[model samples]
Target: MKWSEICIHTTEEAIEPVTNILYEAGAGGVVIEDSQDLQQTFLSDEGSEYSLDPADYPIDGVNVKAYLPVNSFLGETVEEIKQSVNSLLLYDIDLGDGRLTFSEHNEEEWATAWKKYYKPVSVGEHFYIVPTWENFDPEDPNRKVIELDPGMAFGTGTHPTTVLCIEALETHMSKKAEVLDVGTGTGVLAIAAAKLGARKVHAVDLDQVAVQSAKINVKLNKVQDVVTVSRNNLSDNVKGQYAIVVANLLAELVIRLAEGGVADLLQKDGLLIASGIIRPKKEQVKEALIKSGLHVIEEMDSGDWIALVAEKAE
Candidate 1:
C-alpha cells in the first residue's frame, strides 16, 4: 500500500496539539524531529553507540510527520489537515516556520522511518524516559524510569515543558498526595507523580488517543495501580480536589483554565505546576494564575520555555 507522509515544520510548544490534529484527521501515526534533540548529551556510555543521522532531522524548528493512506480523496484530506493545523493560531500556539509539506512513500518505509529519532532520554534528576524498544538501565539504582511508546500521541517526556513539569513533580510532590494531571499526554507526568510517591494520580486528557497512550504507558511503568487514565477536558468532569495539579498546555489554554476556576480543583495550599508557556507569554500566564487565587511559589525556565508553580492561597 502507498502512504502520504504529511510533515509540518512547527515549534516544540505546538507538537502535542498538532499531533492530535493529525491523528483526528485519520493519520495512522506521527513522528517528531526536534532540532534541539541533536544537542542532548548522552547520560550513559551505551548512548554513545547510537549515532544520529543529520540528514534525517531539521536544522531549525521541529517537524511532525504523520502517515495517511493514499486514496481518491487524499487531496481533500490533506487540505483538511492544513486547515486544522492553521487553526492552532486561535489558541496562540507558536507554529514557528509553519510550513506544511508532503511526499508519497511505501508502507514499509513509513513503518520504520520514525524509530531512529526516538531514544532513551533522561529528564530531571530522578527520571529516564525510555522508549519501549530501547534497553535502558539507570546508572543510579535510585533513579526512576518511565517506559513509553507514545504511538500517535504526544509527550515523550523529553520536551523542555515536560521536563520542567517532571522537575517540579520531583520537588513539590508530597508522599501520599493525590495528584491531578490535566492534559496528560503520554501520561509521563502522571507516571512520574506515581513514581514519586503520590498515593493516587488522576491523569486526564481530552484526546482519546492520548488517553489510550497514557493508559499504555502507565501500565508499562507499572503505575496503573496508582494512576488512572481518563478522558476529560481540563478540570471539567473531575470531582473533589487534589493536593497537586499539573498541566503542560498551551499558554492560552492555561489562561482559560485559570479564568475557568482551576483553583477550585485544588485543595487549600495545593500546588499547580503550569508549563508549556514560551518566555513571551510567561508573565501573562502568571497574571492569570494570580487572578485565579494562586500565589506564585516558584518558576522554572529552560531555553525559552517556562514552568510556574503556584499554590492555592489560604
Candidate 2:
C-alpha cells in the first residue's frame, strides 16, 4: 500500500528526457512539475507568492515527480535504483516527495480514496462509461457501453483532450469503417469506436502498461474481437490503411506524425482525428496537417483542449 515517490530535479529542458528515462526504468507515473504546480504546492494557500528565493528551488527549469507503488516490482536495491537514477548526471533525485513537507502515504490506501472521485460519466447519447465496481441499468441493449477501471493509463474519458477525441470519432465513424487508435491510452477511444459500430479497431501505444490496460478495458467492454491492442508506434510495424485514424497525443507528436507520412496509412478519404493539443500550439498542427496533404474537416473544443479532424485529400 505504500507509495514511493521519486523526485528528479532537472532543468526544464531535460525534464522530458529524464521523464522518459525514468519511465523506462519502471515508474508507474511521471508528472512534470511546472512553476504553477510548485507555486501551488508552496505558495497558493498563503494568498501570497512564494517567499523563498528562487535559487533555493532546483528551479533551473523544471522538475519531474514520478510515483510508484512500494509493493510493485519497480526495483529492489538502492544500488539498482541509483544506477538508473544516476544515468541522468545533470539531475538530482529525491526518493520521497521532497516538494510536500509531509509524511509519505500508502497508495493502496489512496487508491480507495481516489475511487470516491469516480462516478459514471456519459460521453454521448449512445455511450456510457461504467466503472468496474459500479452497475448500470441499460436503457437499451443496443446502447454502446464501456466498463473501465483506469489503473494508470492516460485516457479515462474525463480529460477534455480525451472527450474531444471521442467527439471527433463520433462525428466521423461509420458502421463499416475500420478504426486505428494511435496512442490508445486506456483503449477508451477504440472501445467507443467499436461500440459506435466500427467494423474493426486497431489500437497501439508505446507503453507496455498502457497496452495491457487497454486490453483489460477492451475485455471489460467485451469488444476484444473488434479491438486489437499492440505495444508499438505507427512508424513501420503498423499495417494497412484505416477509414478512421485517431491519434490523441501531444500536439508536437501529432504534427510530426501527420507530416512524417503517417497519413499514408489512411484511406484516400479517411479521417484523421488528433487531440492533446494545447491552445497555443494548435496553429502549428493545423499547418502541418495541411502540408501533409490533409484538409481540416472539423474542429471540436472542450475548455482549452482541442481536437482536429482532417481528411486525406482524395
Candidate 3:
C-alpha cells in the first residue's frame, strides 16, 4: 500500500498545535524534525548507530511530517489540513516558511520508522516521561515515571511547553492543593499535579480524543483516584475555585481565558500557571493576566517557549 507523507514547514512555536491538527486529520504517525536537535546532546545506547544528519533538517524552522494512507479522500484531507494550519494566522501565530510538500512511500517504509526517534526523557526535576512500550526503572528515588501511550494526542511532557509547566508545578507545589489542569492533553500536567500530592485534580480538554487519551494516561499513572478527566471547553462554566490553575494553551486562548474570568476560578492567593506560549507572545499573555486581576510572579523560559506563573492580585 502507498502512503502520503505530508510535511509542514512551520515555526517551533507552532509544532504542538500543528501536530494536533495532523493527528486530528488521521495521521498514521508523525515525525518532528527540528534543526535545533543537531545542537542538543541526546542519550543513546553505547552500540547504537543513531546520528542526526544535517541534510534531513530545515535550516531555519521545524518540519512536521505525518504519514497517511493514500486513499480517495487524500485530496480533501490535505486541503482541510492546509486550511486549519492557515487559520492560525488569525491569532497572530507565526507560520514561518508556511510551506507544505508531499511525497509518496510504501506502507512499510514509514509504518514504524518514526518510533525509533521517540525515547524516554526526563522532562522535569521529578517526572520521567517513558513511552509505554519501553521499560524504565528509575535509579533516583525522587524520580517518578509517567508511562504514556500517546497515540494521536500530544503532551507527554517531552515538549518544552509541557516541560515548563511540569517544572513550575514542582517549584510552586509546596503543599497539597486542589489543581485544575486546562487543556490537559494526555493529562500530563494533571498527572504531574497528582504525583506532587494534589488533593484533587480536574483535567479538562476541549477535544474528546484528548479527553479519552488523558483518561487513559491518568489511569496508567494510577492517579485515577486523585485526577478526574473530563471534556470541556477552555475554562467555560468550570465550577469551584482551585488552589492552582494551569493552562497549557495558545497565547490567544490564554488571553481569552484570562479575559473570560479565569482568575475568578482561583482561590485567594491561588496560582495560575500559564504555558504553551512563544517568547514573542509572552508580553501579551502577561498583560492579559495582569488585566484580569492576576500578578505575574514568575516566568520560565525554554528555547523559544515561555511559561508564566501568576498569583491572584488584590
Candidate 4:
C-alpha cells in the first residue's frame, strides 16, 4: 500500500498543536525531525540506526511528518489539516515559516518508524502515561497506569499542557465527583478522573475521531463503566452541573467557551481546569474565566505553556 507523508515545517512551540491537527485528520503515526534533536545527548542506541539526513530537516525550525493512506479523500484531508494548523495562530502560537509539504512512500516505511519517539512517561504524582507498545512496571504500587495508543487522537498525556491538566486533576479531583472533560482527546483527563475515583466522567470532543479514540482508551484503562465518551462541541450538549469541568484547549477556544457560559455547566464552587494556554495569553484566559463568573484559584506553568485552575463563584 502507498502512503502520503505530510511534512510540516513549524517551530517547537507549535509542535504539539500541529501534530494534533494531523492526528485529528486521521494520521496514524507522526515522526518529528527537530534540528535540536541532533544536539541532544543520546542515552541509548535506540535511534542510532535511523538515518538523519540534514536535507530533510529545516535549519531554523522542526519538521513534523505524518502518514496518511493515499486514497480518494487525500486532497480534502490534507487541506483540512493545513487549515487546522493555520488556526493555531489564533492562539498566538508561532508557526515559523509555516511551510507544508508532502511525498508518497510505501506504507511499510512508516508503519513502525514513529514508535521510537514514544516511551513511558509519568504524568502526575500517581498517574503514569504508558504507550501501548511499551512494557512498564511502576516501582510505586500506588501509581495508576493509563495505557494508551493515541491513534488519530491528540492528547498523548505527555505534552506540558496535558501534564498540567493531569496534575490539576490530581489535586482537585474528589472521590465520587461528577466530572466533565471538554475536548477530551484520547480521553486522557477523563480516564485520569475515573482512576482518581470520580464517580462519573462525561468525556466530550467535537472531533468524531477523538470521540472514538477516547472510547477505546477509556475501555483500555478499564474505566468504561465510569467514563462516557461522546461527540459534542465544547459544552453545547452537556447537561447537568459537574463538580469539575476540565478543558485542554487553545487559549482562544477556552475564552470562547468561557464567554459562552462554561460556568453554567459547573456546580457552585466547582473547579474548572483550563489548559493548552500559552504564557502570553495566560492573563487573557484568566480574565475570560473571571468574566464568566469563575475565579482563578491556581496557575501552573511548564515551559511556555500555562494551565489555570478556577472555581465557580458562590
Q: CA lDDT of each candidate?
A: 0.87, 0.69, 0.86, 0.84
lDDT of 3 by residue, 1-314 (tens): 99999999999888877988898899988888878666544334321224566887788789999998999999999999999999988867898978999999998889777766566676678877777876556655578888787766765567778888999999997567999999998898999899899999999998888899989999899999999999999999999999999999988889998999999999989999999889888999999999999999999998888999999997
- Could you give candidate 4's per-residue lDDT for residues 8-84 as a string of tens digits? 99876788689877877888678877675443332122322233445655686778898899999999999899889
* Clash totals for all candidate models: 0, 2, 0, 0
- Best first by lDDT, ranked: 1, 3, 4, 2
Model 3 error, position 183 (Å): 0.4
Q: Where is model 1 poorest over a 10-residue stretch in terms of lDDT?
A: 42-51
Give the range of the ten consecutive residues with the poorest summed lDDT in model 2.
40-49
What is the C-alpha local distance difference test score of candidate 3? 0.86
Evaluate candidate 3 by giving its C-alpha RMSD to the native, one decimal.
Answer: 2.4
Tens digit of per-residue lDDT, candidate 2, span 167-263: 7777778887999888887899999999888899999988887899999999988999899999986544678998988998877678778867877
Give me the runs in candidate 2 sitting further than 4 Å from their true place. Answer: 4-103, 138-143
The total of clashing pairs for model 4 equals: 0
> Which scores greater on TM-score, model 1 or model 3?
1
Error of 2 at 46 (Å): 40
Local lDDT at 60 for model 1:
84
Better of 1 and 4 by TM-score: 1
Question: Which structure among the candidates has the greatest TM-score?
Answer: 1
lDDT (Cα, 0-100) at 144 in candidate 1: 81
